[model samples]
Target: MAKKPEPQLPLGSSSTLRGLTESFSFHSSPESFITSRILAFHKEHPDIVDTRAVVRAKVLNRNVAIVSSHAQIQQVLANDAAGYEAGGAYDELMAPFFPSPNLLLTDGGKHEAMRRTWEERMGSLKENVIPLVHQQTTEHFSEPSTSEIDLYDSMKTLSWKILLGTFLGLEHRDKLFETTEGLQENLLRGQFSLFPVTVNTGFWHSPRKKGKEAKRKLQAQTLAHFKEKESACPFATTDDGALEDIANHSVLFTSSLAVKALASILTALVLNLYLYSKEDGRSLAESLASESDPGRRSQRLRSILLETERLSPPIVGVMRRSTRENIIPSTGEQADVKIPKGWDCWLYFVGGGRDPAAFGSTWDAFDPERYINASIPQGAAFGSGPKACLGRELIREIALAMAETCIGLGIRMQGNIAARGVRGWLGWEPNDAVKPADWAQDMKQLPTQRPSEPVMVRVARS
Candidate 1:
């Protein structure tokens, strides 16, 4: 049997109509950003590369280019070294939470300085952060014993504790978590809100207002913590113009993005382990515990984490904008393309990670061995270039700890995977023989990329 040929984008058709309608608006409905749909679209129309590595369109009244080709996307990210600035329409959507001049907003010298500070501080606290991950994981499972639990909810709570306690150095969870939780919910809602501009206006004004109040409370608490630990924890720098300016930015990053990342990864880990258990007649924990070689065990666990990122990236996409009108040199697929000043660009990571050309024909399969000898393309997970995530190490460590602990506890699915949305945020079971038509239908059914139902799991002592 032969594999089906890749599909081509037809000229003057419904795709163009989708492009027209979608491009006209700067704001993306929560559904529009669903990872599966974008991946399906790119897979369905591989010719986007041949036509132009950059998919040109109008967005937020500006010429927007969605760069899907992995090579071309890397070119755009590295272009930042030449003259491309980081902020864009998506940045505007994030502005309400991250504010201007934060790590994501800054470029060049300022960006370098901030990143350096974070690296030094996080490095100093490695011993603290890793253990904290295990502690939170233990606490979450400690209560339920053998009863079924919602893994999604458990991961979120555990992630919040580690992020708040280990990263930000907050201890008084009673008063602070509520305020932070309020801000986190609003920030999430604002991120996926249909009319993001309305976040701070009229009835929607309440979220923004609540977020502001939360920020104020958080700032005071952070300032106090910094003062108390200033001498002991050199990382909590507040007086200097560098980290202090974006103090609130740190709160949102830890409370929202970090929490979201950890929860998403944990869900992926649980699902993978559950399916593996069913097939192998042993849980991941049992396999891991039986391994005698520490080095091999570490490698295997890390490989699982890497595969999780490849299959279900926590971030759906990475955004960038051109600072000046400049030409992006050609790749094999297309000619050099010019991006006007202020043009917004998106790098679709999910599509790039699953590209058959890049990852071989079984690119969609859940094979951790692919990464043992093979290398993932740059920015395949947390991103690449100057703007890559600074917390990669922290995220990896926490994920490892969570994986080890959950597997050790004999975590397995308790009921049918409870999920919502058309296809749910959690990925479907891997099927190497899935037909293209079935895959497309799955993508179309998804109202939003994120899960709508609780991810339930059970634990038994092995």
Candidate 2:
């Protein structure tokens, strides 16, 4: 194939269509600034709704189309959710790794069916999931809590393990943990390839293909190991009989992103919970600490996580391309702006989740307790309608357990000292330790870690 285009461009020279086609372009652009900018933008960019300027808006291509608006985002995600699809977006970007078809990124009934089947298999562990989460917590906490660990990396591992338990049904986890750990790391690293151009050196492809073959091979090995274990899983569907549908897609890659995304989101949520428990957070932690019972504490934590998701998004939002013919709705006078059949549209979910109209007065606060009487409107935090995040339960369970472990170990983002690394993607890192908290003024807080909002307590063991 001809040489792929380079990844970088001088500021202001990039076009919206070209920006989306390339990976990591936003890093140097003003969008990078928006990713780090505060809730103030929510006030500044009313049309984009809590975002940067129109110049910033025009760069993140949704579909093949080169433009998007909050209104278009609403229609793509909430209005015609089932009608619009995520496959095209996934195909152009994620196809290299997943190779096989995936439901989480696909459209229609097929996506729904795949989601349902995975849910059925995962349901077997409904009760087991929480316990496993608790166990995972204990294991993480059992280690020296004083050491500054990358909570971001740590959460990724824990989430991946939980995913393994749910997907492969591994009973004797002690022996399986290490191998799976390596595999999970390798697999998650493949997302680095999402950069489109191979120039993002620090990010695997960074500025060029440095560890290209090595990264690909490691990713392959990780999936192969997963496939082997998956075959052994009693839950595995047979290729011969009625279970053939399982063979239709690359379950390993298809499922990995959800696990990775869930892991990232869960890690950020727990960080928020830990921070919130502090005197600084919205003060939800005190109630959490007050509750001596672990189950009740977990429930309180769950509400806190959901509220955090609402206030601050893990990824901001999903990108969509208008594939079929249709005019944008909710645009008011601009409804006829002519979004031709093939174009890209970015749904501004961060603003949508925090919209005062959608989330109410405390939308910008760290009030997990506020969630009790109040209700949050539907959003694209875990995606909007059709492609809504299917691992919702799993992400919640694992995150709660992570909080449980942190409560038990007293692990925290040392030093109100926090910093963000590698674009806003590092989330927020606590300087006292390797832990990262919320980087943005995310109505969401330190990685949703914004303290002063939450309150926390520990179980006094005899």
Candidate 3:
């Protein structure tokens, strides 16, 4: 019997291509641009997925190829011959925050060694991190706040506390935790500078300078704390250069980079569950809480989380720079596209997750049952291949613990919740019909997709 051939993606020039100014605007509001421009392109050219395809364009004054197809994206990420390198752009963008190269910015042997060291230092996640997360989450919801709470802010604070406790051996009430929290916030703020350069002159007031100073202080404090409590610290080690490595890795866990990513995911997940409860006329929390079988509850929880991630991925896209000129082979009949050396390749996770070919025709709909059998791809939310996120397991554990705790406590939303600029229940919904004035009014699109405006929801026991 003859098998059906896969559909070919268009190699033709993109009709929705953006120029320099438009590209700059796209970066400023990527979700909005994707909703308005990219999806529209897909609709107009339906043969691709019935519309899953790649679009090439100039982004941030760089020659960029945006890959959206699930299989093709996986191939690009896994293929060394594709010439895509993860470190160049990451190092440049994150230099202000991370004084030394952390795991995200290292590759090959250095990356492997660092990952192994961190894994060893982390010990058993089930034994160590899970218990800590459970404890923190339980304490957080033990006395549920009977007041309107900003969901994003609350989640951010909780994530920061958990990360600090897990890695630095600092309790939430510890003096060092209080002191380093402010420094970490300031350091994160520095990364948002209009110009990505740091001026070190004492006469000038620069965010990057302040950020650099904060990083120095934070690292020094972390090192001293580790030295003082070597026996107690989870990451403590006596190996040569271990202290420096731990301190350097601290920037990754404690900074906005890791903390914000987890927070955004939690915020999105809770919001989705709340919305689902509203639509279904039953509390998902109660449903999970009422289930007697542990396996069923776990499975249902996993499915719900997966669905939420597919709809609203925390990290929308990742940037990879080409190491050399090379051709990216197509999964279908389309000819390979020649990528120039040093060109930036943006892997669009949001788009890939929504690709109808992989996710079915009703890709936009939130359906947890689709994940029950584990037959579908989970998408690139945590990334793929060698460059996949190292903290993925920890993230899952934290998210599961937090979700269970919040629901088990009977926390219910008090009012209508909305992000400032973005629309739809999930906040990052793609709607091409929206006016330009309303797009990205108050949202951060890169690094993570989160609302800049407060997403306020009053909490009370149901």
Candidate 4:
């Protein structure tokens, strides 16, 4: 059988009508925009590496560019001074939660200082973090359950505990968990509200107002908690000002952003392993557990983790704005596209990871073997360049340890999995009762991308 040639769209073209439709689609049906609209566009016109669209709304009308190719994504992310600056979108969306400058908001020297400090602290704690993750995973599934459990919720709780213990030096029995979780929920609701801008008025009950209040309470709680355990913090500094900086930024890590992302990735990982095992007619868990060679086991585990992440990235894309007029340099087949100053560019990770040119013809397949001896390209997962995720390495270690523990305990999906959006699974089954309309209502893309519906599972000790 021969492959059909992909249709090519003219380079550097803008569509007014299509852009308006897309803008409306993004505002009304954001959850499906990527899976249905953007992915569908890529499939239809594979040769279009970059396209310009105007995002029009009541409050704002901005020129938006969507960059999907691996090469183009790498170039944009790597060159920060080429008129592109980070944190424009983040500053707008995450202002309520992270009011102060943190790792996500800072750039250049300030970012380097904070990232280096946190990296050193995390590296020192890596040895202890692995055992803690394993211990938490084991204890989570140790108790017997008469009914199926929500794997997503379980993972979220586990991640929350580990992060609190690791960053804030809080024990499992700490009373702040309940209070913090509530405040975190409130903040997320406010941040991701339907209308981008929220009016803070006393006339009506507003989620944004509630969210701001929650931020204040959570900030106070975090500061007080840190004051009591300041000496025990892994990243604690002798300087009071530096310590306060650490405490302020700690809110971002402990908030729903970090916790939900870790939990979502872990959930997707477990689901992928189970689905792949069934397809191969072999127990991936057994193979991983039976492997006696430590090096081989670790390598295989890392490959599997990478493959899972490539297919179902927790953060689908990152946003950046052009500070000055610039041109995205042509790379191979991709042509140079002009990005005017103030135009927002979205580097789509999902599209880049699944690019057949980069990952082979079977890019969409769940094949971990492809990564066994392969060099992963930049922007494939955690992203590339200076603004890439700092906690990616630590996240991988924690997820792998938790995954290993789950496999050792013989965990498996019990009931039909309900998902808000498709996660690149070829033949996995979803709950039949959920209508197509219901999925749109449940899908969420901000903060983290994961199934909003419960993913039921059963754990049996082997």
Q: Which candidate comes out best when scored by lDDT?
A: 3
Q: What is the model-wide C-alpha lDDT for candidate 2?
A: 0.49
Q: State, as a TM-score between 0 and 1, how close model 2 is to the true structure.
A: 0.68
lDDT by residue (tens digit), candidate 2, 224-279: 55566665343445454323334223245224455556655765565555544445
Could you say which candidate leads in TM-score? 3
Task: Give the whole-model CA lDDT for all candidates, comma-separated.
Answer: 0.59, 0.49, 0.71, 0.67
Pairing residues by index, what is the TM-score of model 4?
0.84
Ranking by lDDT: 3, 4, 1, 2
Q: Model 1 over residues 24-103: C-alpha lDDT tens digits?
A: 23233322333334445467766543422455554444456666555666677764545576755556556655545677
Estimate the TM-score for candidate 1: 0.79
Overall local distance difference test of candidate 4? 0.67
Q: Model 4: which ten-residue window has the lowest total lDDT?
A: 51-60
TM-score, per-candidate, Cα-based: 0.79, 0.68, 0.86, 0.84
RMSD of each: 5.7, 9.2, 4.1, 5.2
Q: Residue by residue across 1-462, what tens digits does model 4's lDDT show? A: 344333232233255546656656554434345445444456676775323221122212456666666766777788654467776756677766665777787766777787887777667768878888888888877887778777778888898888877777766776777777778888888876655556756677578777778888877777778778665466746777776777777777787778888987887777766645635466566677778998988788888888878766777678778887767665445445677777787777766676666776566666766568767652256878877888888899899988887877876545444443443332133323333344356544555766656767765665
